[model samples]
Target: MLQRPTMPGYAAPQDLIRRVRRTWFLFFVVAIVIIAAALAGAEFYGRRSAIEALESQGRTDANLKVALLTAVLERPRALPLLLSEDQQVLDALSSANSQAIEILNRKLERLVTGTQAAVLYVVRPDGIAVSASNWREPLSFVGNDYNFRDYFRRAMEQGTAEQFALGSVSKRPGLFISRRVGSAVAPLGVVVVKMEFDRLETDWQSASRPVYVTDNHGVVLITSIPSWRFMTSGAIPQQDLASIRSSLQFGDAPLAPLPIKNPAILNPGASIVSAVLPGSGEAKYLRLLAAVPTTPWQLEYLVPIETPVASAVQTARLTALAFLLPVLAIAAFLLRRRQVSVMRIATEQAMREELERRVVERTEDLSRARDRLQAEISDHRDTEAKLQVVQQELVQANRLAILGQVAAGVAHEINQPVATIRAYADNARVFLERKQTDPVEENLGAIAALTERIGTITEELKAFARKGRVAPEPVDLRGVIEGAIVLLRSRFSGQLNALDAQLPPPGLFVMGNRIRLEQILINLLQNALEALGDRSDARVEITVTETSDEAAIAISDNGPGIPPAILDSLFTPFHTSKEQGLGLGLVISKDIVADYGGRIEVSSSDRGTCFTVYLLKAKT
Candidate 1:
C-alpha cells in the first residue's frame, strides 16, 4: 500500500449529474428568495403611497360635504332668530288678532319665498301653530299642534333649539331651527324655520363616492343612499332608544346597524371596511369622518379601495420582475467573469499596491478637508438657530404693538353701547314707576338690543386679537358698508347724518371675511368723522365702484386734510398725526386688504382727504 496507492474509483456519471443538479437547484432557490424580497419591498412602498393618496382624497371629499351641509343648514338660521324678534311677529303673538295674524302670515310668506325656506311658523306657548309661511297651502302648518315636539319644548325653555327629525305633518326629514319670542318671563311664542336637505342629498347622490351625515346617536340624518336614511351606525342602548322613540326623532323607522363589515380603523378619523352595494357585490371602501363644528354631527365619506389596491399590487409585482431579471443576469455574468479574471488579477497585484498607496495619501487629505467643512457647517447651523429665535421675537413684538394700538378704539366702541344700555334702563324704570307698560317694554327692549350690540363688538375685538381666522369667502360690499355705518351710528350720529353714501347695486361682492371687511370700513369712517369734527358743514362720502376684476371703495372727508408731512407714512405702524393716536388702525386695515390680495392708497390736500381700498372682485 505504501508503494502504490490504489487509484480512486472514478465518480459515476449519475452521481456527477446529481451533484450538479443540486447546486443548480440551490442557486435557483436563493434567486427566488431575493426576487421575492424585492417584490415585497416594492409592494409595501406602493401600497403605502396609495393609502396616502386615498386618505388625501377622503379628507377633501369630507371637507366639501361639510361645507355644502353648513351652507344649506345656515341659510335659515338667521331667519328664525331675526323673524322671532320682528314687530309683526310679536304683535301677532301678543294680540292674536285676525288682522295682525294675516299681516304676519303675508310677511312670512314673502320671507319664505325670498329665503327658499321649507317652512316658517310661529307656535304659541300652548304649542298651536298660529302663523305659517305656507298658510295658504293645503298642507299648511297653521293651527297644527306641536306640543309633543322636542324643538318646541326646548325652545320655550332654552331660548333657542335645534332638532333634526321627521316633520309630523309633512312626514319629511328636516332640521327644525327654533327660537323663543319675547322675554323669557312671558314668552309669547316660538319661531321655527324648517330646513330640508333634499337638494343636498340629490347632489351627493351624483358624486362618485358615498357621503352621509350622522347625528350624535349615530343615526343617518342625511345620506346619498335613500335606503340608508334613518339607519344607525351602531347599536343604541335600550334607554337611549326609548328616549328617541318618545321624541319621535325618526318616526317609526327601525334604528339598526348599517350594512358595513370588518371595519379596521386606520387612524382616529379614518377606517377601511367592506360594504355591499345595491347592484354590486361586496366591496372594500376607505371611510373617513370629520366632525361638523357647531353641531353634534359628523360628515362621512366612503371611497372604493378595490381599484387602488389592485393597481398598487400589480404595478409593484411588474416593477419587481422587471428589475429582478436584469439584476440576476448581471450577477451571474459577474460571477463568471471573476473566475476568468483570477490569473489577470494576480498579474496586476503589484501595480494595484502602488496605486493603493497613492489613494491612501489622497484619502487622508480629503478626510481633513471634510472635517473642516463639517465644522463650518456646524457653526452656520448655530448662527441660523439664533437668527430664527430673534426673528420669532420680532414677530411677537409686532403683534403686541398692533394689539396695544387698537385696544383704546375697541374700548371706546364698547363704552358707547354700555352708556346707551344704562340710559335705556333708567328710562325703563321711570316708565315703570309711572305705570306706562308700553313705554317701559319699549325701553327694556332697547336696552336688550344695546346689550347684544355690546356683546357683538367685544366678540369682534377678541376675534381680531386671535391669531387664527376662518377662510375668506365672497362678502357683499354693500352689506359690510351698511353694517359699519350702523356700528358707528352712535359714535358720530350727527356726522353720519350728513355723510353721503353712493354704493353700488346690492350684489357687488369682494373676496374677504365679512367681519374683517366691516372692520376696515369702520376704521375708515371713524377717521373721516374725526377729520370733520366740529365743522357745521362737514361732509363725508363713501363711494363704491367696480372694474372688470376689482372693487374700489373710496372714503372722502371735507376738512383740513392730512398733513403733507405725514401723508407718505400714513399707513405706517405707530405713525399718526392725532395726539391720542396709537396709529395701528390704518396699518391693520392695510394688512387686511393685502391679505385679500388688495391694496390701500391715500391722497390728501388742504381741500380734503380720501382713503381708497381696492379689493379683488369675487367670481359670481
Candidate 2:
C-alpha cells in the first residue's frame, strides 16, 4: 500500500485533529468533576465548620465583655461602701454644721475626680442630700432630696443597694450604688455614688460588635447603641410595665421590645440571631451571653458570622482549585510535549520566516529612530530662530517706547531750529533786497545749517527707534554716552546742564551693539534726571573706569537716593516709584548688558543713588 507524502517530522492532519478533540473531551469531563466535588465539600462541611468557629469566638468575646463590665462596676461599688465607713462622711452626716459639711464637700469633690464615680453625695436619714462631690457645679446635688428614689429607700432598708435609673434632677441616667452609714440601729445616712456608663459604652462601640446589658426586668441598662437603652429585651407584661413606670425609674422610655428577630439555636449555648443595630443595618450574629458580676445584668455579645462564613467557603473552593489546576496543568504539559515533538520540522521553517520578519522590524525601528532624531534637530533649530526673533522684537519695542516718551522734547528741539531757520531766511530776503550778495549767501547758509541740525536730531531718533538685533562689536564708550545725552537734552532741558560726566579716554571700547549700549545709557540718565526733579542743589554724575578685560561706568545722583523700599526692585519690570511709570527701563537695560556678558549694579543711600554698568572690554 502506498502512504500519503508527509512532512518529515510532523504528524498526519487527521491523527492530530483526533488527538486534540479527545484531549478536550477528557479535559471537560475532569474539570466538571473537580468543580462539583469542590462545591459539594464546601457546602457540606465549610458552613458547619465556620459556624462552630464563630460560636467559639463569640463565647470568648462575651466572657471578656462581662469581665470588663465587672471591673467597671466593682471599682465604683467600693466607693460608696468605703465613704460610708469614713470619719469625714460620718462627721458631716452627724455634725449637721456648715463647716463640717463644707469640709466633706471638698473631700468628696477631690475623691470623685480620682475615682470613676460621676458624683458622690451623703443623704440624711430623712433622704435630703447635704454634701456632694458636685457641690461646686451649677447643678449641685448639695440640696436635692432623694427620699423617693428606689436606691435610697432600698439602702435604708437593706443597708446597701444598687439601682440604674434616670436622675430626676440631672435628667441623665446612671447606676446608683448606695451604702448605709453606721449600724442599722443608729444609721447615719446613705453614701450614694452615681456612675455613668458613657465610657464603658464607648469601649463596646470600638469592638465593632453589637453588645447590650439587660437587667433582671429585661430592660437594657447599658448598650453599645445609645438608643437601645431603657428598651426591654422582650415584651413586658402590662402590669409589670405599669409598676415600673409608677416607680419613675426609667423616665419617659417606651419600654418596648427590642428589634431582635429570627432566632435559631446553633448549639446549647450559642445561637444565631438577627437584629437591626444602629449604624450596622440588619445582620445575623453568633449570639452568646455572660452574666455581669453582682448586678443581675446579662451581657449579650453578637459576633457577625456571615462574612467569616462566606470567607471560609471561598477558601475551601480555592483549596479545591489549587489541587485540581496542577493535575490539569500536568496533563496539558504531556499533551504539549507530544504535539511539539511532531511539529519540530515545521517550527524550523516558521522560525526562519520569523527571523526575516524581525530583521525587517529592526530596519523599521532604525528608520523611526533616524526620523525622531531629525525631528528633534529641526525643533531645536526652530526654537533658536524663534528666540532670536523674540529678542529682536524686545529690543525694538524698548527702543520705540523710549522714542515715544521723548517725542515731545524732540519736536520742541526741532521747533527751535525751524524758528532760527525762518529768522535766517527773513534776513536773507532783506539782504537780497538790499543787493548784498555776500550777506544773503551767509544768511541762506545759516538757515541751511539750522535745517541740517534739525535733520540730525530726527535721524538720531529714527536710528534709536529702528528694530534690529546686531552682533556685538567694539563700540566707543564716548559715542554711547554722547548719543544718550543728545536724546535726553530736549526732554530735560535744564537738567542736562547739571550732568557732570567723566568720560573714558578716546579709543576705549566695550563689546555690545551700539544701539543697545545707547539704550542702557539713556535709561540710566533719564532715571537720574527724573529723580533730581528740578531740585536747586540737584547734581548727576557719570564716571567711567576701564580694565584690560572689562569696563564699568557708574552713574550717580545727588537727589534723595532711590527710596529704600524701591531701590531693591529698581531693575524689576513693572516695579516703579513713578505713578505713571511702566517700570521697564532698567529691566531692559539689565537684559541688554547681560546679553553682552555684563551686569548692572546699583547702590543708594540717603544722599544719592548710583548705578554701575559693567561690560566686556573688546580690542579696538
Best by TM-score: 1
Which residue segments of model 1 deviate by more than 4 Å?
Answer: 1-19, 334-620
Clashing pairs in 1: none
TM value for model 2: 0.46
Q: How many backbone clashes does candidate 2 have?
A: 0
TM-score for each candidate, following the candidate numbering: 0.53, 0.46
Q: For candidate 1, give the lDDT.
A: 0.82
Which model scores highest in lDDT? 1
Off by over 4 Å in 2: 1-41, 318-620
1-620: candidate 1 lDDT, tens digit per residue? 00111113212234434544565577679999998898888888778778879999779878978987887777788988898889999999999999999999999999989998899999999999999999999999999999899999999999999999998888999999999998789999999999888888988887747888999899999999999999988888889999999988899998878888899998899999998766778899999999987899998889898889778777778878887899888876675455335423442353345345645778775555546545754775698689989999998999987777567657644654666566667778888899999998887887787687777766766655563344679998999998777667755766777689997898898999877787788888888898888899899999988987899999998889987778878878678888977677887687778767799988988999899999998854
The RMSD (Cα, Å) of candidate 2 is 30.6
Clashing pairs in 2: none
